[model samples]
Target chain A: MDYVEELKKDFRYIEGLNACINCGVCTAICPAAEVSEYDPRQIVDTVQHADNDEIEMLLKGDTIWYCGECLSCKTRCPRGNTPCYIIQSLRSLSIETGLFIESIQGRKQLALKRTIGEHMLKYGYCVYIDEIDTEMFPEQGPVWEWLRDNREQILTRLGASYRQEKSGALRKIPEESMKALQSIFDVTGATERFKKIEELSEKKAREMKISFNSGKDDYFRHLYEGHND
Target chain B: MRYSRNEVWETYQKEIADNNFYFARSCIRQNVLPAAEDLFLKIIGTDLGKNIYDDARQTTCTGIAYHSGIIPFETTMTVVAHLFALMNEAGYENYACSCVTSFGIYSEVLETWKHFPEKEKEAREALKKATGKTFEIPKNLVHASDLIYKFRKEIANRSKYRLTDTTSGLPLKVVDHIGCHYAKIFPEKGIGGAEFPYVLAGLIDEWGGQQVDYPERRHCCGFGFRQYLLKSNRGYSVANSKKKFESMKPYKPDLIIANCPGCSFFLDRWQYVIAEMENTTYGENGYGIPVLTYEELAGLLLGYDPWDIGLQTHQVAVEPILDKLGINYNPDMKYKGAGNSNTDSPEQPSSIKMF
Candidate 1:
C-alpha cells in the first residue's frame, strides 16, 4: 500500500501537516518525548519524506505508541500544525492494517479492545466500578475498597440510585437503548473493527511463546502490563 | 473566535443557561463521584432555582473509547448525532455536559461537522434512520462547572463558608487544575483560555480563596486515558501528577480544585500511589492535599453537609479543610453514616483534637 496516499485520504492527517520549519517546539514540550523516545519532530520528518517501507515500520513500531494524546503539540506549534492529530491517523492506519499486531505496545490494542471496547458496547460505560478488580487496581486505596464493597447502600446514601430501574443517575440502560447503540456500532463499522482486533490478537498470540486462553491470559497479561516491549 | 487578545477575560464570561438545559452525565463522574452530581442537581434545581433535565436514557459519550481507537470515528459521530436527537426530544436548546472528555468530543465532533459538511449529513442520516428523531443544534454547549463559574458571585452570596479560614481569619490558598480537553483543544472555548483558564479560579476568588500560581499548573493530571488504563503503564500517569504535586508542594496550598471527574479521580488517587512509591507525604503527617471538584467545593461553602455531599469517598481526607474553615461535620460519621450515629466507625486521623 502507498502509505503516503493512505494518509492523504484522511483530512485530519492533512490538516495536521504544514511546511515543517522543525523548530523542535513540539518535541521540547511533549511530555511523552521527555519520558519516552517519542519525538514529534522525527515522526513528522519520517512521515514527510520516508518511503512506504519506512512508514510501514512506524505503523508497527513502539514510537507511535508513546504519545499520550494530550495534544499539547496543538497548543505550541508555530505553524498551527498538530503532530498529535497526525499520530492519531497513523495509529488508525496501524490498527486497520493489523500491522499493530507487529509491535508490543500496538499489540496491547487487543487488551484495550477486550476491556474498554467490550465494556463500551456491553455496560454502556467505560471503567465500570464493579469491573475494577482490587487485584488489578490496588491503587484505588481503602476508601475505594469500602465504597466498592457497599456500592448500593453507599450510592443510595449519596442519592444515586445505582442499577435501579429509575429515571436518574447511575441507572441501568434500558433494552431499546442498548439495541439502538448496538445498531449504531454495527452500521458505523466499529463492530467490524472490533472483530479485526480480536482475530489478529489471537494470531499474534500464537506467534508469541505465551499461551492465550481467556480473560487476561499470559500473553494478554504481558502486553497489558508493560509497553509491548 | 469570540475572544480578544486585548481584554482580560470578557470573552469567556458569556451567558450561561439559567432556565432550560439538557444535562448529560459523565460516566466517570456517575461512577466515581456520584454525590458531586447529586449536589450539583440539588444546588442548581433547589437552591439556585433553575430548571434542568436528566434522563436515564442518555448514553455514554463514548469519548474514551473513541480516543482510545477502540470505537471507530464514524460510530462516535453517529452516537453524538443520536444524542443531539435526544436533546431535541427533550425540547432543550442548551447542552450541559458533565465530563471534560464528553465536552471535548462534542467540541471535536462539532468542529468535524463544520469542516466536513458531507460527513455531518452522513451522521445525521444514519441517526435519522436508526432512531427517526431529528435535532436542532444546541444553542450553547457548556461544562457543568462553567455554570457554577457563571454564577460564582451568586454562589458566594448564598454560601455559608468563606474562602477565608474562619478560625485563623486568613485567606485559604487554592490551586486550580483544568482538564486538558476542557479548553486545551479549543482555548477560546474555555473560561480563561489554555494558559490561564479561570473556570475554577473564578470560584476561588468569589468564594474568598487565594488562587496560587504554580509552575506546572498547565500539566495534565496524568490521566492519559489509554496509558492510565493499562495497569503497568500507570507509572507515567502517576509521574505526571508527581510533577504537579512537586511544583505545588512549596506553595503549601490548602486544596486543589479540578473541573474534570477524571482529573479529580487521578489527582486524588495518584497522591496515595506516589506516597507509596516515594515514602513521603505532601501534607501534615500521612495526609495529602485534598482535591475536590467545583461542585464539592461549592457545596462545602454553601453549607451542604460534607458526608451527604460524598466527601467521605475521597482518598485524601477533607476533614482538615473542613476543620480549617470551622465547618461542623459529625467526626465519627465521616466514614460510617453521613448523618447517622456511628456504630463501628473507621479510625480517625491522629491530628484531630476532638471538641
Candidate 2:
C-alpha cells in the first residue's frame, strides 16, 4: 500500500482530514508552526495533493515530526479536521515503514522508545524518577540534582510514598498491575511497534557505523545529543 | 471583541463533581513536584473535608507514549479502560486527573468511544483479554485544576495569605498558562473554553491576584514530549518557551502558573535554560518568574511550608514570591535533609538567581 493509503487506514487520519480549505487557522494557532517552519496547513495541503512519492518524502522528512501534538489545530479547523491527528498518523506510518530514520527529528523515536516506552513497561510511569539524572538532563537544574540526592528524605517529608509499597503519591505500582500492562502492550501491537523501532534503528546505526549496544548506548546517545542549535 | 466574555464563560462552564474523586496522578508531577500531589490530598481531604481516594493499583494512562507515537491509540484506550476499571472497583464515579495530558487523553478516548462503539468494544475486549477486567467509564472526568477551580471560593476563604503583595497591598500580576491539552483538543471539556480557560485565572482572581493577559497568553509551554525528551530537539522545546517568556516579560508578571505537569516543569526549568543561554531573566532582580502548579499555589495560600510543599524543588526559587506574600519560612531550612540534617547548598546559576 502507498503511504497515503496507509495513513487513511487509521481512524485518526480519516477524522482529522476532510478537505483542506487552506484557511490557515490551524497554522495561525499552532505553537510548533510559530517556532519552526512547520506549517500544519501546508502539510495538509501537501498530503491532500501529493502523489505516493510526496507522501513517502513527508514520511521520511522532519515536517511531521515538528508538530508538538498540542492539537491546537483541532480547535479552529474550519473543516473540523485535526492536523495534529494527521501528523500523528503520518508519524506512526513513518515509524512502521522504518522511514523515520531518514530525518534528524524522526530518528529520535529510538530515544523515546528506550526511555518513555521502555520506562512504561518497566516502571509503569513514562517519566520515572530513577531514569532522570543530572548528567543526562542538566536542564533539570542544580536543585534537581540536590532533590535526586535527597529524594527519599525530601519526598518522605512531603508525604509522598516514593517507592514505598503503599497507596500514595509516587508509590510503586504493583507487580501484578505491571504484568497486566505489559500484556496489554503485547496484545495491542505496542510491543511489536517497540521492536520495529529497535530493529530499524539498529539497521540505521550500522549504516552510520555507530555502535548499537543495549540501554543508552553509542547509537542511542548519538541520536539523543547535539543539534540543539 | 467578537465574543462576549460573560456569554463565552457561561457557555463553556463544565460540571465538576463537588467531592469523592478517584485521583489519577501524573508521572511528571509525582516525580518532580511530589508536594503538589501531597498537598492536593491534604487540602482536598483533610482541609476541605472531601473524599478523594488515591489507589496504588492505578498505572499510567500511557498518554506520554501515545503522544510520542511509541504506542498506538488501541494501547492507550486499553490502558485508560483499565484505569476506569480501577476507579470503578474503588467505587468512585468522578475522575480527577493530576496531569493535563492524561486529562486530554481520557477526553480523547471517551470522545472516540462515544463516536465509535466498535472502538469501545475493541478496548473492552483488549482490557478483558489483558487483565480480565470489565470497566465502567467515570460519570465525570475532570482535570484536578477544574476541581480546585470549582472550590476556589472555599479555598479563598481558608487562605492564610491572599495573592496580594504584603508590601504593596496590591494584587500581584499573575500569568496563567493553561496547558494546550486541557482545552485545545476538546474546548468543551475545559472550563472557560479553549481561548480563555478560567481554571488558573479563577484561582488567581479569587485569591487576590490579577491575571495578566499577554500576547502569548494562549501559547504552549512547549513540552512537545519527544521534542523535549530528546536532547537534540530541545532547542525547539526551549525556543517555544522562550517565545512565551519574551511575550510575558513586558507584562512583568509576578508569577506564572500552569495546570499541566509538563507545562509547569518546562516553564520552571526552561527559565534557567533561557537565562543561561540568552543571559536574560524575566522576573525582577535576575530571578526567573516563579512558575507554579495550581496545587502549589493553593498550598501556599493554605499556609503550607515552602519546603513541605516542595517549592524548594523548583529551579527558579519561590522565595521571592514567598517573601511577596509574607509567608514566613526558615531560609536556612531550604536545603535541610529529612532529619533536620543540613545538606550542601547547590551552586547557584550565574544568570538566573537560585536560592
Candidate 3:
C-alpha cells in the first residue's frame, strides 16, 4: 500500500511533488472534487509530506475514480504539480489492484452490447433502455417524420448495408495477430464480455417494436431515424 | 484568422503525429469506402496506402471497446503495442489517428505504457510473438487535424476554389468546434488561439471562408462518453449545443464546421433533439444551422458537388445556404434542411474589427 514509491516513479512528469504550497486552488477548480470527494490538493499534500499510508488509502478510495482526468489542476497548480494526472495514475493502480472491478467491469460490456445491438439489429445508435417510450420520442415529430419519410434516403446516404461484407475482401489477418488477439480476449475476459453484450443487445432488439431485415440497411435507416417500430 | 502561440505549438504536435502516421480504419468508413482517408489525403497530402507499410500488422485499436471499458488494461496495452508495431514497421516513431478516440487512446496507452514496463514489454512481446515485430513510441504522436493545420498554407495554395458572394462579394463566416478529446487530452498539443480554438477555422480561412464566433465554443458537445452514458442530463449535451447555436446565430454565418465526426454528429443532430426537448425554435424562423466537416466545407469552397461530398447525409440541411448564395444546386439533392427559410434581411455589414 506504500504508493509514495509508485507515485514518485509513475509521475516523473512532476519533478518536484514535495514543492506544493497547498493553497487549495487545485481542489477548488477540480471538476471531480466539486461533484465528488476526490480532492487533488489533499492528495498532493499527503504525497508531499510523504504520508505513504494515507496516500495508499486515498488511492484505494472512491475519490480517485471520480477524477475526470481533465487536468484543470495541472494548468492552475501554482506549484506545478499535476494532481489530476496523479489521481488518474493512482486510479489505474487501483484497478490493477482489483479495486472497483465489479462496478467498472460489466457496465462497459453492457454499453458495448447495447451499442452493437443498436448498430447491428436496429440500425440506429443505441437508445437508452430507460428511454424506450414512443411518447418521449413522438413518432409524428418533425425529426421523426423526416426520418420516417426519408428512411431509405438516409440509409443510403450513411453507406450502411445490412449485408456482411464478403469475407475475403477484408485485409487478411496474420495468423499470429489472430492468435494474440485470441489470447488477449482470454486474458481480459473480453470475449465473454462481448458475448454477453451481444446476447443482451439481441434480447433488447427483440423486445423492440421494430425489426430490420438488412443489417446494413437497418443500421443506416436507424442512424437516420427511418424506422419507428 | 490568426493563431495564438499555443495553437501554433499544438499544430507542431499534430505535425509530429502526421509525419509519423498510423491510419486506423473506421467502421463508418468500412461501410462507406474510406471517404475519411480520401478526404485526409486530399486535404493533408499523405496517401495512407503509400505511407503505411504492407507488412505492417495493423489491428483495430478496439477504441469502441476501450471507450466502453469492456477491454481491460492488459488488452488495451496489447492494442497500443499493435499501433506502435505498425509505426515501427513503417520506420516511423510517431503515430496519429484519423479518429479522435484513437488519438485519445494512443495518448492514454502511451502514458500508461511508460509506467508499466512489464505491460509495455508484454505488449511488445505480443506484437513480436504475433507478427515477428518490435515497437516503440517515436519522439511524439498526434492527431491528423493537428497535422492538417500545420500545412495550412500548402493546403490553401493547392485549393481550387475561391470565395466570392454572388450578390455582395463578402466571404462566408464560419464557427469551429475542436473535438473535446483533442483539446482535453493533450491541451498543450491540441489546437490553440481561442481557449476553445478554431484550428480548423484557420483551415477554413485558408480555403476562403472567414471563421466566426459561437457561444459555448469551448464546451464539449456533451458526447463526453460519460455524459451520454450516465444520461445525467440530456440538456447537458443540448445546453452545449444551444450555447454554440446562440453564439453563431447572431453572426448568421453560412455554416458551423467541425473536424471530429462525433462532434459533427452531436452538433448536427442534437439541435433538433434539443429544440424538441426545450420546446424552443432554433435557427432562422425555427431552423437549425448546418454543421459540416472541414473536408465537406473545403470541398464546397473547392467546388465539389455537395451531393458527391456527402453533404446530403447531414441531419441539418445546408441547401438553403446554397440557395441563398444563388449557386445553382440540384433540388433533388438527397440532403434536406430543417423547415425554415431566410426571413432575415441580407447579411449585416461586418461589425468585426480585427485587432
- lDDT of each residue in B203-242, candidate 2, tens digit only: 8767888878889899888888877888887777888899
Candidate 1 backbone collisions, by pair: A104-A228, A105-A228
TM-score of every candidate relative to the true structure: 0.95, 0.97, 0.67
Q: What DockQ does predicted model 1 obtain?
A: 0.60
Instruction: Compare candidates 1 and 3 on lDDT and give the better one.
Output: 1
lDDT of 3 by residue, A1-229 (tens): 5566665555332433637888998787654554445677787777677786776666446555444444456556666677755654554454444443233322222433344333322321223222232243331133334433443444334333222221110233455555556665555545655555445434444545335333333322342232321
TM-score of chain A of 2: 0.95
lDDT of 3: 0.52
Candidate closest to the true structure, highest lDDT:
2
In Å, residue A39's CA in model 2 sits off its true spot by 2.0
Question: Evaluated with TM-score, which candidate comes out highest?
Answer: 2
Docking model 3 quality class: incorrect
**Colliding pairs, model 2:** none
lDDT of each: 0.81, 0.88, 0.52
Q: 1 or 3: which has the higher TM-score?
A: 1
lDDT of 1 by residue, A91-150 (tens): 889998889988877888878887887776677777677787667777787677778877
Name the 10 consecutive residues with the lowest summed lDDT in model 1 chain B: B346-355
What are the candidates' individual DockQ scores?
0.60, 0.77, 0.16
Query: Model 1, which residues run further than 4 Å from truth?
Result: B1-7, B10-12, B337-355
Error of model 1, residue A99, in angstroms: 0.4
Candidate 2's C-alpha runs over 4 A off are A227-229, B1-7
Better of 2 and 3 by lDDT: 2
